[model samples]
Target: MTNPLKKYGDARKERIDQLAAMSDGSVAVADAGTIEEAPGVSLIASAWRRLRRNPVFLTGLTITTLFIFLAVFARVIAPHDPAIGYLLDKVRPQSNPIPGPEPGFPLGADNVGRDFFSRLIVGSQQTLIVGVFATLFGLTGGLILGILAGATSGWVDSLVMRAVDVMLSIPSLLLALSISALAPRPSQWTLIIAIATVQVPVFARLLRGTMLQQRSSDHVLAARALGIKRSSIVFRHMVPNALGPVIVQATIVLATSIIDAAALSFLGLGNPDDRQPEWGQMLGQAQQFIYDDPHLAFYPAACIIIVALGFTLMGESLREALDPKSRR
Candidate 1:
């Protein structure tokens, strides 16, 4: 019988010969083994690529993108006339047909005969505006106050922290309500201030804590030892490092701000003269139709709920994406 060792050596020699022939017989490889591929891109790039792999994230992103587009182009995208009132059609339920010869309204008409679909489209503008402004205001105020408190740890920190503590102790909604009630009718700016006020304490606390933790890190210490200006360390170095959490928090706060703004608007403080086509105003108007035509209220309520949910889901997805600890 043929020796097993001789057979193994022949197989190995054949493989080497095949490789040498492939390389034009110019070079010979004594031993060849499987080679592993090089490592992929950076963590962020890898994370992003992996994120695209997730169907849930993609679906959420698509929904959010569509909603944003709708909000941005409400006037163009709306099927019916948002402001035009159909004298013939009023209090039409969502499930009912349109107002015509066998007319069918996909979304139906409100108590005022306004197209529910159109109004809903316009309402997106209000939510986006409120969410964006409230977040900006909160982020701005938080950054300013947090930086001040964190950089200075003496009486300044104590004062700022105590103020934040006091604000935090109060119920955010209650505080907003009190301010809304006490203030004269609110303009857009007024509403922004009210929402920002509620959000500031939360952001301030978050940023302050983050700053405190980063203040003593090696990079910060090294910068200090290198004679880097304190301002440079705080703004350029520390703030950037601490921003991951801030971004996640901002997304969440944006969603909360939208909901809060809607609540306040529902209470009559939303639009100055109730002329604006805001979701909250629609909600307020919806209340009047509760006993009569429930559809008027339902349409707006559904829009608010849906938009709020979309924002919440987007925010949560953003958090998961940005937070390393949450990554698999």
Candidate 2:
């Protein structure tokens, strides 16, 4: 008996070869000037070309770059040891524990007399770690669930979607708060886990929605007709096309993760060690002396706001740039 599948593949391959030969012959015969079209730019390259010209993107890029630089070089940037608080005895007074600017300390000291300037610089490190790791965790989990749901159309999709729906039902903040509160200890890892868990549903839904759209796309149908492996069709053809929105969402989620980490720290569920300074921890401590030393809260709050704004602006600019129909 003739192998039907093999015959079908061979027939398709022959047709493709003939088409390639015809295209080659046509190009050879055509005049150079007849091909008026410019060379095509890839999607990523085009998006980057657009982003380079956008001022909003440049501003956001600058802020985000500065923030990352501060985080990475905090040890070298901070003059004093954040944990030791050398200025403690010098800055502390009986009447007013936290003192204003002194010789060694430019921003003065925290409520506990730790060098506020040094602490603020180090705070960037903690914030970056938490925000980045949490967002990564969420993105990873979401990708897994999205792939599962998108690649298969049956009970598997329903099961994954149901689970995602369950997660989405709960308020994100509340879910994070609950998880943080339930942790055995208040630490950086705990905060990251809580925030990441809350973020999973958002990422999963976005990817899945895009994935479903890709499932019925013409390219996908053609890929199937070409007898490509199921895995290749899902990852190479479908997932890559579906990732644009998810990538934009991930950038915005970075800002949210930082805010959530700060909120958790502010609520006293964050790391208890003063040795490791965090903006939220600073705010929580400053709350006691907010009326007398409002600057304590002001500085850290400003850092948080600026960082969040930078990520949001960058994400928005990226989305606009990546959009095919955008005027830009």
Candidate 3:
């Protein structure tokens, strides 16, 4: 009461002393605006960080990488030429003796005595090529149609959407089957085109919806206000932003493409040359000997399953990374 200023000074000093007593590591102090915020990480980097922590993503990445490696180095990795069959082993009747894994042929011999391991390694190339190219063709066509529809209003949007709807009305495999059947020489190229055709409507619809949403976003509005050309805004701004979903979808579609290629091959629409050593063709050949040598079907089927699982896991993980809402 007698000296109020003295009491206030003592209280301030006590607080200061308390803070000073705290260890530097224990007490973190920063000016309001001067505190350093974390550096901005790019979306890809952030996604990668998150993916690294995920088991599903890791498994998928590993399998996919292994398959890609096999596809690229098929010749180098394969122990024997896929085309050369064991003529002596070919003489063994399916009923008398069914081959199992042995020296040189770790995965055993197929119905025609081809080295199962060698054919499998070589077959990866064909599967990957078909999946990749078919997806590319479909994606390109879809992007064009979707961008056109999304950038323009009125009749263009209606026409494009309607066409996509019509295509979607039919089953994808059935449509692909019909297309492949109609081709004059349903080779690998024809199969690719058929699978790609089925994929077009899927990508078109996805991009169209994505573009419609992005068309009115803040950045797009800003670009329009800045007198940016419509084409530039559409192609440069909207399309780029909308590609996240497309990329995820493309991964999933690739798995489907591989499966479809296999299916077409299984149905006798794949490569006519037996020497090509495709997984589906192998399965087709193994059908008759399923009872005697089920291992023949198991190998290719397992490969297909593993490859599809890899793509699926990767796609789902990517979807979770890209969309915050899905994280929950």
Give all candidates' CA lDDT scores.
Answer: 0.77, 0.90, 0.86
Candidate 2 TM-score versus the reference: 0.87
Ranking by lDDT: 2, 3, 1
lDDT of 3 by residue, 1-328 (tens): 5699999999987887777567564544433236557999998898888989999989998999999998999989999889887734544673545466788878777656678889988998888888999999999988888888888899989999999999999999899999989988768899899999999988988898899999889999999999999989988999999988998999999999999999998998877787877888788888988876788888898999899899989999999988878872
Ranking by TM-score: 3, 2, 1
lDDT computed for candidate 3: 0.86
C-alpha displacement of 140 in model 1, angstroms? 0.6
Q: Any runs in candidate 3 off by more than 4 Å, and if so which?
A: 1-17, 21-35, 88-90, 93-101
What number of clashing residue pairs does each candidate have, in the order they appear? 5, 0, 0
**56-80 in candidate 1: lDDT tens per residue?**
6676667668778988998888777
Error of 1 at 207 (Å): 1.2
Clashing pairs in 1: 97-104, 97-105, 98-103, 98-104, 98-105
Q: What value of lDDT does candidate 1 attain over all alpha carbons?
A: 0.77
